[model samples]
Target: MDLEILNQEIDDDEAAYRVRVVRRVHYLTISRKPTAVLDIDTLCRPYLLIPKLPPFPDGNWTKMRISQAANGETEHVLSWDPLDGIHSLWHPRQVDVLSLKRTADHKARVKEVQFDGRILLSKVAIFEWWIPRLQRETEFYERISKDHCLGSGSVAPTFLGHIMEQERCVGFLLEKIDGRHPLLDDHPACEAALRKLHCIGWVHGDVNICNFLVHQSTGHVKLIDFEYAEPFEETKAQLELQKLKDEFSQMTER
Candidate 1:
């Protein structure tokens, strides 16, 4: 869909602005100056367009434009601020837009996307709409990357980048690991990885077979889904550690 913001009329007394937006899709151009063209899929319904706006009380609207950067490639720079409420459209350069293929439909609405011709997974959490689970997961990945406690071989999928909405991180990108069939043979390595993470002052609060991925060829185990992970306390960590040990012992005995 091609959306063009023709012009904005602002009323300073009421602090409100009326915006005119023209929507065009399927090779249709709406306005004289169409700032952005969005190719949307019909299956993805109830499309949510979060506008990134500048700070409040600026009282200025920046028109969306595509300018040639030093690299000579055109960059889409869009900024919009409307008065009725706080509505701004801004897309950060660092955020990568993935083609969402599937949705988990859970509270967090975990999504699967194809990135760079490969299946990459993503999870989104709106700043105000949803709880802060996505943000927490992002933080965990960042900390793990910096601390380097978990060995590179056993680490979960690589953290790609964040998905931003309105200048805030609402989602994150992660490497998708295939062949995640559950196997008791991978239990020991998964336990070891969790132990390493705990030693770094964190605990994977939710630990199960599903969160452990076993590489079909190499048998390497990678721990994933750290949304429930939290800072480790000596007492609680010990209890959880023992529980994990018992679980693995039973699996091995079988």
Candidate 2:
């Protein structure tokens, strides 16, 4: 698919935000899955140099739309109508909207980002887009930092945030790890870290090679993401341990 960078505008109104981009994407067809392959390098640069977003029609500040691109087959390549506003944001796993209370967990910042299929790119680029969205809310990030730095301990970005809908599934954030080699596929450090988490009365349902991060400075490994963490009774520890063992076994087999 051919997606040309057109124009983007960010309308920030408290908790509501609308990011509109005007661009010509070639393959938004039924047989073809439309992909938004954003490059990290392209987004790294400051957005001030880009052209200002076209003014909204009828001067309705609450809603803004952009005419993306025009094609021979269609009028425009990709376009979105005026997005009204973001309503109440939901917690990842909280079933009752009334229970969408923010957590009081200390040590790391937590925020939500869009996890829909519309955003697509390399893994790195995909991460780059989602990271900022989590950090954009100043209040959320600052609160967690006051407690402790969350995520991969030794400088690698920690994923303390989540994207759960039915259950509380989110990830966290931490300082970026630098110049560190990840642990070998089979290493004791993996089990040790999970042990630490269990001791803290937390259970990580998913503990694979990808879930752990190594701190190069101290050779310490950190448990980064807690999306699957849940409180488990002692009686369930054995079951959970078996699950963890099974997960590790599968990783080793692969």
Candidate 3:
């Protein structure tokens, strides 16, 4: 859904309450504009499931969707006139997520986010509403479309992006690994995949079964989801390294 925050103001009576011009959300597939206004607090409520949060007044990356970039050429669908449609998210720095209201509509529900209007990114995902951390994550994936994990196995998004409702602040875009199935035990295929990732120094923060996809036809496996991945490491850095090794062993054994 297309989301745009216009202007925001605080209520004189309450510290938590505020009024803002919330642009009507539009499903990218259907070019519709927001026809209503929404009032919310500068501070969003605790709904998004975050184990810990970054220091306030600061912005961190979050995942919003998991999808592969659409390959076939089609008319561009997610564009709007600057004067008519609200184009981007509010700046992430200026706004804080105090409360999030879930929509009844499933489609609208997946694209909604709860954060202040302060922090915003210039790059907006025209197609998807997931991956709040990086707008248009699928678009970003397009940048890495040519990248490969093992020697021959091809990788791509398996599903469209989806929002983690429990963790309202985060979003994810999953890729479809067309014909590959994840290696269950220690196998050469798994080792090659990890070796490839290590050669590039690319880290997969959450290396679990759910985070992987296998192509049945080629035995090619593709990795997806980067909600928690970062080049910079902190306390659990070694653990991440170990996890990669473990995955290698598991696949080799299979």
Query: Highest lDDT among the candidates is held by which one?
Result: 1
Q: Estimate each model's TM-score.
A: 0.55, 0.38, 0.35
Q: Write the per-residue lDDT of candidate 2 for residues 75-185, one digit (tens) a residue.
A: 212333332211223323222211223333322233222233221111110111344333332223333344354444422243232322122222222333432434445
lDDT of 3 by residue, 100-203 (tens): 33222213213333233321112222223234434333333433443432234433343223322222323332322344345455245554654445444445
RMSD of each: 13.8, 13.5, 17.8
Q: Please, what is the whole-model Cα lDDT of each candidate in the order they appear?
A: 0.51, 0.36, 0.35
Tell me the TM-score of model 1.
Answer: 0.55
lDDT of model 2, residue 118? 21
Evaluate model 2: give its TM-score: 0.38
